[model samples]
Target: MLALIGEALLAYVVIVAVQILINDGLFGLAKVFVQRIRDLPGVDLLIGAVIKREADSFLRQIDSKRSPTVEMSIKIPEKGISHDDLREEMKQLKGEEVNLDDGQIFAYVYTAQNEHYKAMEDAYLAFTDTTGTGTEKGDTDHETLVREFLRAFMHENALNPIVFPALRRFETETAAMAADMLNGDANVVGSLTSGGTESILMAIKTYRDRARSLFPHIKSPEMVAPITIHPAFEKAAHYFDVKIVHVPLDSDFKPNLDKYRQAITSRTILLLASAPQYCHGIVDPIEEIGNIAREKGLPFHVDACFGGFMLPWVEKLGYTVPKFDFRVEAVTSISADIHKYGYGLKGASLILYRNSDIRKYQLFAYSEWPGGLFGSPGMTGSRPGGNIAASWAALRAIGQDGYLRMARRLMEATLALRDGIERIPGLAILGKPEMTAFAIASTDSHLDILALADAMEEKGWRMERQQFPNSLHCTILPHHVTLVDKLLNDLRESAENVRGKKAKGGTAAIYGMVGKIPDKAIVDTFIKQFLSDVYTCKT
Candidate 1:
């Protein structure tokens, strides 16, 4: 009897093992089928084209009233027109009836003040006139000067400390400056990247690599971040093949730390918090999250790309901000953009790590390549020195005092605009934002935020429309200060005009439809096609 019982137990164990194998095989097959469906011919391309058409349609609707009615056509006659004559003809294509006036458009013209525009335009002309041996040579010479200025300003590539000592020095100094601003320690280190997206990518890459090194047994890696965190993190997960665990936000629009704690697991590599995220501009609870990271021994990254430059100065001006930098023991890395609030030219941002040890994972080096030893600290090869120079110049030119004043003006203007929006009967502010960027939504079901945005656009204001709650967004700069009252007046009038109107046949309709789509894969394909179309030029 004992022998029979032992034999039965062994048979049961075998059956259970067989069942596990079958389940694993089925799951793998399902994933493969899904991937195959996504790759089917014409699927992605058709979706992408439709998405582009929708976007183009929206832009056309907005510009319809302002667009020139006359279409210009040229007879080829098997010969091209003279360059000068062609230029003149192109100038004639400008809308004669439409008013091409100043201070009418928003955001596109950053330095719209008459004096600033004049200065910038004069600089452009002066640079254009400077000549060298030939036209191409002259252009090369001009670009060389700009490149040299940038190299000298940034001190060259940050990847090789031995080859470019000055570049390394500048990088070190810049990292120190950034860390100090974010209340980091002397051990804090970081690398500069092209922009906020790249910075976020590097941070994610570092955490992934570090987790792999420390926990080799884990077959999958995951990250926990607030939904409000920049979509760049989602892009990173897609690129790096990591699972993203999104945490919901609280009433204040900050990530709920308790939910984040529950989401943590042995496979989790990183935790991310934003210093006033881009969506609703509310800061997460960094200190509590930092402590959680410390307890879990997980790396925490703070995405301050939007507010990094302004927050430090704002805090100095006596604004209460939560500790969200290296000052917190659990925080390991930070990303900041010099282009946005730093007032630098575009394509400049920095990523800081807690120490050199953690930063090494971000470097890409290949010694066995046929082209000899190749190494890049960040994403791109053949980096632009001009951007670095401009960033350096802007930092020096602005100084602490200049930034402080700019911050004060922007804050005042933003507060006034927020107050004005709040006064609107049906509109509600998304969150308690402490920065110059905020979102406005409709409290009444009948009021459509997109319709309000469209109406505002008709009155010469360009407000961003958002989904997932259907809201209108705005980013306040120094120039917007003077236009705040005018904007509020226009908004009030637009709201009154659109009162009781349903959101139909505008950006509102497109976004509303897109949000309800169940298959995210289809939506992603459409986005890719839209981007491709944007780069295609029409003749």
Candidate 2:
């Protein structure tokens, strides 16, 4: 009787556990339902508040502290600070920043000696006005010259045909210059954007709107792109409520055309290919992709933001670059950055369309409000006239001949670096790079490339680490031309130092762990923590 009672108690415990599990499952389902409900339009603010509350509650439960911090209260000051004080503060802040002028850093900044920097400074000082044309902002004479020269024509919006006619002309001419460089026909037209990301965003949003108008049945619009495509497309899809279909790459790092074709469906509204993708710097199989798009009646956009400004010159310089621009039949649009290889100001990029009809979708216009008619091309309302002016100036100053020379210098530097890297025992270039940017990875498992990267970092050399094959990436900027040999020497020494060693600390360790983690969410959490630490407020 005792044994039977014990068995009965065991059975009862098992039954209770099963019941608990079912309740937990039901609770999880309810949470998902609530999340979907929160995603409804016009409830974003409420959802944001709810999420913040829940996040705070969870943090408290586990003792997690994550928040954006400020140096002090953001309220208006009763007293004004002196220019000397402001200058001192800025100097102190910048003292902690990386020295980009040294050409040691490989990422974030693109510097070409000091002339470009000086030019940018001059332009900035000249157009620092908040008012239309007056010195009400109280800037230097140079700013006055810049304002009087080009900025005075910038009357807020590019949509207004009456105001800022010269601004429109500047933009139109800039677009034409870029279009001609990309082998665009007479129909090709585009707009200067804030940057590469904005250019890409504009292209994606344009295709989304175009699809919506033409194929109204595509309620859940989708975009198809290679796995090697930039993250801007992902961001645009997230913002615009479009689904993304990522196609896997082949062994050669190009998008597998078969996989891309298979991934397409009735919902797919757009197609994308990148010229020299940022990771490995391999251009996608764009012509083949274009052929497919032509057959499928889809709008194909080539993201040449990385190579747009340089590739034209590269091809002209006699590099066997594959066809990727408007010359292709199915290619409907392209996004190229003038700021990158063009050596223009930081906030300059162009998004071009094959015809005005497609470009029209990217523009926004509204006259329904009491504020009267308001219209704008691309993104942002009060577009920065300074960026446009600076870009125009840079292009005029650095003519195609100048760009060709820069491209030539970079290509020579790239080849030298690639040759040096190839000569290393356990290092290899990721692909046959067509441009100045390329990746080098560890060929032997014994050599820890991440550790090598860390060692190189210790030597004041900034090398960007890549995943999958575990590599180090560098863009051969014009500034880096003279340092190619030094870079290779450092890389060789770093590889020797870190051979077969564990990257136990620093960025290498962080990246090593990140590379191994199959679940990306944990890495994302760690990133969030890092961000929180970065923003830790003294107050």
Candidate 3:
């Protein structure tokens, strides 16, 4: 026993040395090391200690710079705080948040004019049941349907659709509208989800279940997707116990069709393509992949969560967009966010199947529970009806004309931004972005892209930092339409400012190390620790 224990300890030391010595970022040294010693005694503890040391170092650096937070009680208050006092506190707290309204933020919040925001606010509050009103009749006008119908059904629970048929109709109509926009015939059917992640989860779960029923031999079902496919799919795969095989992209940032086709196997249950993938905003060759899926007899899902609400309009505006919806016969399902380009409040997305037969797998039903028979079409029970109503309202109010206008304006801004970036001496846009989202990279090594991002941050611009190749992601929105020229000027100056400097710290240094780290486990551990630390109460 002592000899075996000493052997395990030596193996652990060797594994740690391998991690430190590996120079190639793509080498699988850690994976091999872990595979060999994973079952050894104390190996888990050794790995845990390394993770803790790294996490503690990063957290201390962050903690040292963090501003003092507002005092928060760990326990429930003994007495209710006054509404006015709470509102004042909220206002003060919000004062520290980034001002997205200033058009300096390129990610997270997406907003149009103040009028549209007001409409969403009104629609949301009207359906929140705070006003305490019963059912009331309303006209069929779209805005009226949003305000009056939502007000009438505000007290209704969406979980019991039979009792609240209005919510049922709202959800059905919303799905149908999305289907039609995606070029699905009457055969296409779907359900509303909380957001993109839930939509993706439902799609993945449906396919996994379908595989279980149809191909029981596929005990360990796998999904094949481009590496650039949204992280939501990764989350879904993790949650559903599905292994995902990632295909690398070409120089153009689009998936290599041959590589993608080769990734599929007898165990592969689903093939995923993205309509304008998030990182580089490049749409995969969906038609080609759809054809491949058809030939392979596999289910194909298009994650249009980022572009579904905008691509149709973009195509209508005369830009060449590759076919990516039900129009491609092999596409089994699609997930799109209504809150994004649909101009709705958050918490609304649609997951559509080619037909009801396929969608049935997404539904969950249980009669064994003593709480009575329960059937849910989505992951969540007791979903908010307000989100459904507001989503429908946003789509109805926007119509095709409004969307086309927004699409045109956004595309114009995107092209102008692209042109401006290309004109800059050391900056270049990565990939041919099919939509308003794209990544900016440093063409010259001397100009550190992340350093440029930090300079932009100093100038009050919020940019999303991306890895796998350090770049800055920009998502152009309606609010960004007027800020294009100013943004270009700042970007040009920032690129110049970052010209010969190494990114020593801040987001640059962190993301730089993360991108270069060969063993992704270290990055994963750091990120998990960061997430836990951020949510913790340091007070």
Best model number under lDDT = 3
> Per-residue lDDT tens digits of candidate 3, residues 180-285?
8899988889999989999999999999999998899888999999999999989999999999999998999999998998898889999999998999988899
TM-score of each: 0.71, 0.72, 0.73
| Candidate 2 lDDT (Cα, 0 to 1) | 0.75
Give the alpha carbon lDDT tens digit for every residue of 410-490 in model 2. 888898999999999899998788998998888889898888888888899887988877788888775576788899899
Which regions of candidate 3 fall more than 4 Å away from where they truly are?
1-155
Q: Which stretches of candidate 2 lie over 4 Å from their true place?
A: 1-161, 532-536
lDDT per residue for candidate 1 within 1-539, as digits (tens), equals 99999999999866755675587676655655556676898886777688779968976675564444323221111222233442333234222222225334322123454687668655643553222111121234323343334433331333444333334433445566667667776777777678899999998888888888778887899999998889999999999988899999887888788899999998898998898898887778889998899899888899999999888778778877777777788888889997777765457799998887899899888987896677888887645444554444344444566667777888888888899989988988898887888999998777778889989888878889887788877877655768888998998888888988876776767687788899988888988898899999968
Which candidate ranks first by TM-score, i.e. highest? 3
TM-score, candidate number 3: 0.73
lDDT of each: 0.71, 0.75, 0.78
1 against 2, candidate with superior TM-score: 2
Clashing pairs in 3: none
Pairs with steric clashes in candidate 2: 126-142, 126-143
The total of clashing pairs for model 1 equals 3
By lDDT, the candidates rank as: 3, 2, 1
Worst 10 residues of 2 by lDDT: 68-77
